[model samples]
Target: MPHLVILYTANLNFPTEEGGDMSGLCRALADTMIAQRDETDKPVFPVGGVRVLAYPAAHFAVADGSGDFGFIYLQLRMGRGRSEWVQQRVGAALVASAKECLAVLLTRQAVGVTLQIDVGAEVFDGKLGNLHPLFK
Candidate 1:
């Protein structure tokens, strides 16, 4: 149940002509999530459980109240069970991928990218989907 939510400022240049679009970012991140493995060499995150969603914040303000600044915040929410080492590994991989995807914009503009992992302790988490079958 690793769901990645990407929130980026509208000022940033997304969907670049070279195919650095939102869908491309999602594919990169989902691939990163699926590539993670535990110490036992087993998959860290389920392939069918990986979900990546991106949204642009049209109304926002970056550091120093300068509209020229842009930012991207990535939050990965997953069910609580994995060890700290696994979490850290996954986070590092994801952050690297995100940065790589945004490298051009980062160098050209005032942009900040941050990623965090949030282990959920949900009281009642429900789900209904047929995606697992497709993965099989």
Candidate 2:
């Protein structure tokens, strides 16, 4: 099965244009998050191979507000075992990653982009796998 992760911090004042610039603070936060992932054992994936994004649409299904500028990271992963409850586990891990210090990266003014960044690491389960979409 395919797994997804959505890590986000809300109410950030990011720019609206495609060329919009993220505040220095948010940039720093992203850098730090990457570093943390590189050192962490949770996802058990390397930083370079991971996908990180902001202005989410896939995993961070926002119910309220518009143009929210929260940061998000999605990482599709594998367990090498059985796991039907992966959704809950992925959701929990994302929520845990989005809390506190990094949350400060967002501002109330940047409500143009969804306060959701998507990071992904599509995994395969004895199948063709999500990686094919990118490599093929």
Candidate 3:
């Protein structure tokens, strides 16, 4: 089965919700995403055991104490290569939601409008794999 890795981020100084307010925002975004998926089939959002990561930028620790927060990824983890359309759709939705969530949590200047999403496959360590052992 295909799995999803979700990362939820927020500014350190970005006012923390006292009564689980932030959770609501996350749910809203997730719900929005689930709604956009093809309902004719299966559920997009994970029912349980969802992988989540948090990325905190050093810049967010500036004088005002605003931590630049972001999610590492919310990508599909499957044996089969992820489909372009699926990645694009999910990425777009996540980015939009993150930016909106940040804006609501912090000031416009503090919340960056741009989001950068990358996959491990996009980078290499210059190490040869078993297939290239003989060649090396």
Candidate 4:
């Protein structure tokens, strides 16, 4: 189970150029996650459990109190049981995809992007949903 959450400043609205929308960025990253594979060419994450979400912070302060500065923070949380190599590979893919998706926005504005991965440490986790059935 791998979930990617993105948080960005509200001022960093989607650029006017193509592929500059928030939904498109989320979808592209999710697609990138779906395409990841291990050293043996096995799927990195279960498609049924893969999720991507993005939210804009309406209230926030950027560096130097400049409202023109924008930043995007991406965090991928997943259950433990994968090799470091696999994790690195997945991280690279996700970051590359994100950069590509935000290319237009980056050029037009001052943007900072950060990607982080959080491995399992869950004391308790539970889920109840029909989405898994659709994937199965």
Candidate 5:
């Protein structure tokens, strides 16, 4: 399972004629993650377990007080047990997807983008709902 949390500065205006909407960006990122495949060419992540959410920071200071400075931070959480190489591959793929999604905003304004992946303890992680059927 993988959950993506997007945090962005409120100074940024989404859905601008120049920049795309945040909701759309989130969906693209989620789809990108779901498309990831392993060495065997099989889906790396469970399609039904992918989730993407975004939060706008109402109050944030980016390097300087200049409102022109914006940022998008992504926190990715997933179950443990993958190899280091796989983890790196997934992280890189996700970040590339994010960059592509925010390309317009990044080129038009001064924006910082970052992604972090966290593998949770298998023992503590719990799941109740099922979206697997939909994927099947």
Candidate 6:
């Protein structure tokens, strides 16, 4: 299972101007993960297991205080047992996808984007959902 969470500054875009399309960004990220493949060209991640969510920070402070500064932090959580290569592939793909999604915002303002991947403890993690139907 893989879950992607994106947290971004609220000022990244004008509130009245659609606010940078978080939903579309999430979709792009999830799609990128679902499309990853291994050396043999087999799918690396389960398409049904991808989930993406985005949150806007209501209050925050940037180093310059120009209000033109923005940040997008991505946290990816997944079950353990994947190789380092796989993780790198997924991370790289996600960062590229995120950049494309936020291209306009980045060009208009100073933005910092970061991505982190967390391997969840198998003993503590639990899942009870069915998204296989969509993948089928």
lDDT of each: 0.87, 0.40, 0.45, 0.89, 0.84, 0.83
Clashing pairs in 4: none
Instruction: Identify the superior model by lDDT, candidate 4 or candidate 6.
Output: 4
* Sequence-dependent TM-score of model 5: 0.89
Expressed as tens digits, the lDDT of each residue in 60-128 for candidate 2 is 544464555444454544344324343344444444544433343343343222223233444632554
TM-scores, each model vs. reference: 0.92, 0.30, 0.44, 0.94, 0.89, 0.86
The sequence of per-residue lDDT tens digits that candidate 4 reaches over residues 1-136 is: 7999999998885776565788898999999999998888988888888999999999988899755999899999988989999999899999999989998898888888999999988898888888878876
Regions of model 1 farther than 4 Å from truth: 15-19
Best model number under TM-score: 4
Q: Where in model 3 is the C-alpha error above 4 Å?
A: 1-11, 16-41, 55-79, 113-136
Candidate 4 global TM-score:
0.94
Candidate 2: which stretches are off by over 4 Å? 1-11, 14-43, 55-82, 85-87, 105-136
lDDT of 6 by residue, 43-66 (tens): 877888888988999999877795
Which should have the higher lDDT, number 2 or number 5?
5
Instruction: Please give the clash total of every predicted structure, in order.
Output: 0, 17, 3, 0, 0, 0
Better of 1 and 4 by TM-score: 4
Model 2 score (lDDT): 0.40
Model 6 TM-score, 2 decimals: 0.86
Q: How many backbone collisions does model 3 have?
A: 3
By TM-score rank, best first, the candidates go: 4, 1, 5, 6, 3, 2
Q: Is candidate 2 or candidate 3 better by TM-score?
A: 3
lDDT of 1 by residue, 51-130 (tens): 99999998997888845898889999999989999999998999889888877777668888889899978999898989
- Those runs of model 5 whose alpha carbons end farther than 4 Å from true positions after fitting are none
